[model samples]
Target: MTTQQSAIYYPAGEIEEFLPQIGRVVEIKDHELAVFRTSDGTIFAAENRNPHPKGGPLAEGIVSGYYLYDPLYDWKIDLNTGLVQAPDQGQVQMYPVKVENGQVWVAL
Candidate 1:
């Protein structure tokens, strides 16, 4: 069996470089998260912690309206709903990601 391992690192204050690709996954502090771009060119951030065995990473989690999918349980939660998905949810943390002067900046 192949196990997926995560490499935790923070991209806080480096939003420019990472903003170009919408729906891309980035790691912060060893946790996986998703970076998405709306049709209006607005960027949104969400946690990519999947609880299912065949689920994908946070970046692969579904985004609909203001909620992001859990990929495992197929649960939906608000993107701005903070790091933890819910009480006892054990979701990944969501960080504030932004781009300025062509640079991606994540609030640590």
Candidate 2:
């Protein structure tokens, strides 16, 4: 049987609160998410934990263009696709984000 998952969107914050090329950690229920706004104004969300064995927090990661570079291991993870860049092998969980009436919303 196929199970359907209904997404629940939570208000992350005001759109202006997220600076471009910066990762902001937001907690929704039991999930910790790292929300990012690219220089072009596109918003993306991903799991705040890095996939590396020694990695821990991704919210403190550096945001460059469309990818997030984990400071602990310098693991490059694509904010849009959640895939670690070449030479690295792992993926983070990505979430759907949207802006409504100037409010940033993230769905999981």
**Best model number under lDDT:** 2
lDDT of 1 by residue, 1-108 (tens): 111233222343344433332467766666566776544445666665454445456666556655666555666656665343554354555666555564554544
Q: Which portions of model 2 miss their true places by more than 4 Å?
A: 1-6
Clashes of each: 12, 0
Tens-digit per-residue lDDT, 5-101, candidate 2: 5767888999999999888999987899989898899999998888898769888888888888887897889887999999989999998887889
State the TM-score for model 1.
0.54
Whole-model lDDT per candidate: 0.54, 0.86
TM per prediction: 0.54, 0.90
